[model samples]
Target: MPDADRALPAHPFDDDKLHEECGIFGVVGVQDAANFVALGLHALQHRGQEAGGIVSYDPDVGFNSARRFGYVRDNFTKASLMDSLPGQLAIGHVRYSTSGSKGQTAIRDVQPLFAEFSVGGCAIAHNGNLTNADSLKQELIERGSIFQSSSDTECIIHLMARSIQNNISERIKDALRRVEGAFSVVAMTRSKLIGVRDPRGVRPLMLGKLGDGWVLSSETCALDIIGAEFVREIEPGEMVICTAQGVESFHPFHPIKPRFCIFEYVYFSRPDSVIGGHSVYETRRRIGVELAKENPVEADLVCPVPDSGTPAAIGYSQESGIPYAMGIIRNQYMGRTFIEPTEQIRNMGVRLKLNVNRALIKGKRVILVDDSVVRGTTSRKIKDMILDAGAREVHFRIASPPTMWPCFYGVDTPEKDKLLASTMTEDEMRAHLGVDSLKFVSLDGLYRACGQKGGRDSADPQFCDACFSGDYPVKPTDMIDKGFKVKEPA
Candidate 1:
């Protein structure tokens, strides 16, 4: 377990935002495909840091695979490893645990989960969670399917294995039909690479092209890493199969109104990447502008919590006419505090990661802008740190609406009962954090920032705002059937 490598930090203030589930990358018709996959996975390392795996197919050797528990750079970047995985076709995955799963330390659970069928062999890598996996797994096991890994992704393989369809594409379609919730899947056969986005497009998958080759990745940044030209985003409810003969498209699922995850702009994606034809950085800046319009605060300066909050803080500063300052300096070497083990280590983790700039903040009324506050622990700790540094007043401006509901798609959010906003009012949250004021961007403002002209259209929502709004696009079948209650929105 990752917790065994280092003590899992027990601090309340550790990691108050949602965590993306995993990243997927695949390429076909590229010489030294594994190397390109390594670079692509490196670019996507931020999406998943716990483990990475790559599966490649060379006609001579058939299929080759390497799965390890650690950062992609530490595992996939070595020359020897890449050489061993040489092929014209490849797929890779970097993973954190699937949402709601725990104590999963087995490397077998890592991805590019492979299987051999009587028809032909293939490898699959998936981002996002399956809401109906448990029910499917139970049925499959009852029918005598021996499971290899505990990951929900393996359920796809099992379903594919039992599929009556002869063609690989048909089998994949059949498997997907049995599952529910968000998925952006990349798969490989010896002669082809395939990418599929679920009906609602709750997760992101983009198509790129390089020298007669096709690439598919969870983010556009991966395409940028390999000098691949952006082809287009794979459409919701769409599947693209790339082969030497060229590409073929299919829409096997019944169409629904697309609802891409809105939080991708609020946090998940790389700033440089484009989603829905808009730059993520620009979207975040626009979010800041919306927050400023919705909840303006008077203060001497606007400051960010660092890295994640930087762009929004700049936007807030510009719109609110508050000077933007880096009142805290981050220690680049320190890892995230959420992974720290003991409370003592957790308490020290923040100090080790960030230092207050006492001179700049002293006696200044500071406005701190951040993406969102889940548990409020991190916000409280930072508030104390700033006050101790002599800030006269602290106000918080959040770029997203209160994360009152837990995300069941792919993000690792706390259970609804544990989310601070789920249980507290704005006044209670401000008092708890010891801040003069706390304001979150309204849901409509967030939608407008995403380029929705008249704010959110409830009848045909533009994106998935389940974390902020109680309207989940897809029913969380497994969670609901298992008796896990979703708290009613306050």
Candidate 2:
């Protein structure tokens, strides 16, 4: 991804920026996998603007793939290129890495990776993390296995090859059991489109249908992009197979618990995307309502940071009876804007991709609603921008609770020290942002707003709370830090 739209600071100092996560999409039982993949990926662009790729499968020629580390448009703009990726079944991925995960940062680590064996060919796309991947990869490597990428997903591919089983479903089940993590996988084979969510359902995966098509997408938002009707989400702890023989469903390892990532409602998902029966919009709107109830602020108007902040801002405005306004105009064409690398740009940065509406911010005391504050660099710069824009006062309202921990399930966030909330108290965080007041949604408020904090057997009863609570279902070892080098013997 290009940093032209980036919050580039001329020098390093106090600045502001937020990190982004990636998105996943897939369409099977379709006539043109590439075209559908392109369309679906486009819809998911908001998930990860950094890189994109698609894999098309045809029995006659094997798997045909196209991958680019930039925006989807950068690679899939030509009609002929789409022609090159010919197949009726396809799965694709878009990516954003925070700073750690080596395999995740490399473009090659982008999804829809393919591996072939005597058993058959497999192309898989995944969203979320594998806690045990580092250990699993080390074990596989010790057994003389070679890895092409740093992704945990490669572990799954390698394990499937190692299984040597005749049954594909059994192979997937076996591989899934050995690994502990939060994954929602969409795997494509010569004859089938298989979808599986972790037994805990830490992430979102949905099943959809259009005409004679059976669609397996990371979220229902992709289904809307391809004119597919929303069917129910793939059940947690269950595997759903959509193939020519018809659809089959089974639960071999039921966890009896659900923990979908609360961030999906706060930041990761497109507000239009519905997961586990809760519309992202509804989830966010409820957050706003909850915010109004929890923190009543006196401001002239409720202004969201824009885009992701709009729905929650609207909810806040409606519930608080404050009119909502677009205080900052986003430069949509600002390319793939990334975290501002330095401080000078941070000091003077006023939205490399955002423009403050002087008319909106000039005189009124403004309340700014944003999702979360990462490095505090971006938030500080943005707050300073609002202050410089002539605002009477600036109050920052974060939709979710303070993110004190880094996400391991592939959110691409930076290390713990970089997380502003991780090192500061609410008062300290308030002092850093230079805002008149700083408030974040409480843990209870966030859970209640997202409709994710619920008991067992609830309709949408899955949530990934690993980041907030350090009970990672799986935690990789320091094979990277402690040096798990697979260099051959000299």
Candidate 3:
């Protein structure tokens, strides 16, 4: 279904295929809520690693929406832009392209899509994908409903439109009953902020309180931005309504075991962000400790690449008796310029996202811990930068095992052919990354790091592990880009 849109360029790097699923946040009952929502969206930028948006409600003007189809800070930080947007209630979304939702003009596609229904103007922002979107859309389209965006969120809006109810909560529940997939939704009516997660709790939505107002978000990290104290996570398949009446919650989906996407703890969420009830920092630290025990590396300093790698580096340092130090400093101002137009610009790799600290790395044997390698491009560039910075040796260490297959369930690891580990031998990978030596933690090490991988974690173990094990949750007949479909025709 998405083939025409994903017609990639002939050049490998020119093809911008790898994508990310992202973060969403909503707040009701707070004055100056737009500004606070802006701050909250900033913290959850890691969840989406792509675009951001926030839409708010005004008693006088009705609804106002402003979105930056890139990072929140860079996109939403204009003095004039902030003053123009005024509201007391708001909903926000940051997106990664995990669900193959990208189109010809994604900037135009950026959302918190605003729609008008008979009841009034209601808007919705969504995180997570719907496995049943196409079918649902087909059903809706056949019923004469029109769609403005290709995103599955439209179906929810359409469903709500068909329902006959004055109360937004009742309409949302009626709509929620028709869908079955991993969806964490936050919808805003003229004056109400509503939150819902699918019954199985396939995704996450948490509730927090800031002063007397109520906040709903995909991660607790967002709440921290607005000084909102965590009240509780929105229960699986539960609907939470936040208005002047406080909150009214409901459950509408069939119950199933929670499969909270362990990868969220591993690499998806920011370390400071908690998933379900687990600490991302603590989880990565455990990974590092396990890696040290299973694949001990002899290095002078355990250093991280900054941001995502810090937690694992700390764990590795504690587990291996290696001192953890800041060997690399990030160029927070730089756009992960990996998206630049040419290889000439892209070649200046680590300098784009980060820069090495010469004082820390010069003449030192450095163990560089990172999350995972996809195209082998970023890893290679980082290694070269460390060497250029004068590290005596750059030993590469990955916290997660190699991503050998593609992920279909919400991450954009679409095909195995482009994956580094899927095709190359480990030695080949080391050579590609241009490291002095390289070692990945064993699969066992990675799992043990997860605190009983076989036990009850919020996410299921039979994850769309196609990215690592090459065994998809629901295997395809062949990789013909059926658009996340379970099997090709026999």
What are the per-model C-alpha RMSD values against the true structure? 2.4, 6.0, 4.7
Clashing pairs in 3: 20-96, 20-97, 22-48, 198-237, 199-237, 259-459, 259-460, 260-458, 260-459, 405-467
Ranking by TM-score: 1, 2, 3
List, residue by residue over 453-484, the lDDT tens digit for candidate 2. Answer: 45222233345654554344444344234542
What overall lDDT, based on C-alpha atoms, would model 1 receive against the true structure? 0.87
lDDT of each: 0.87, 0.74, 0.73
Residue 77, model 2, lDDT: 68
Give the best candidate by TM-score: 1
Q: Pick the candidate with the highest lDDT.
A: 1
Q: Against the correct fold, how does model 1 do in TM-score? A: 0.95
Candidates 1 and 2 compared by TM-score, better number: 1
Cα lDDT tens digits, model 3, 1-490, are: 3533232222233122334466778888888788888888888776664566788888887788886655687767777777666778988888765543442325435668778877788878887766667777888999999887667777888899999988667888898887755678888998899898876565678899989899988788888877899999888778888986699877766776555565676677767777656687898998888778877867899998677778999999998998999998986655543443477765554465578888878899999988777777777777878888888888888887787766645566646768888789989998887787777776656666666655332244523344565443433322333554333233
Error of 1 at 407 (Å): 0.9
Off by over 4 Å in 2: 1-20, 98-107, 337-350, 452-462, 469-490
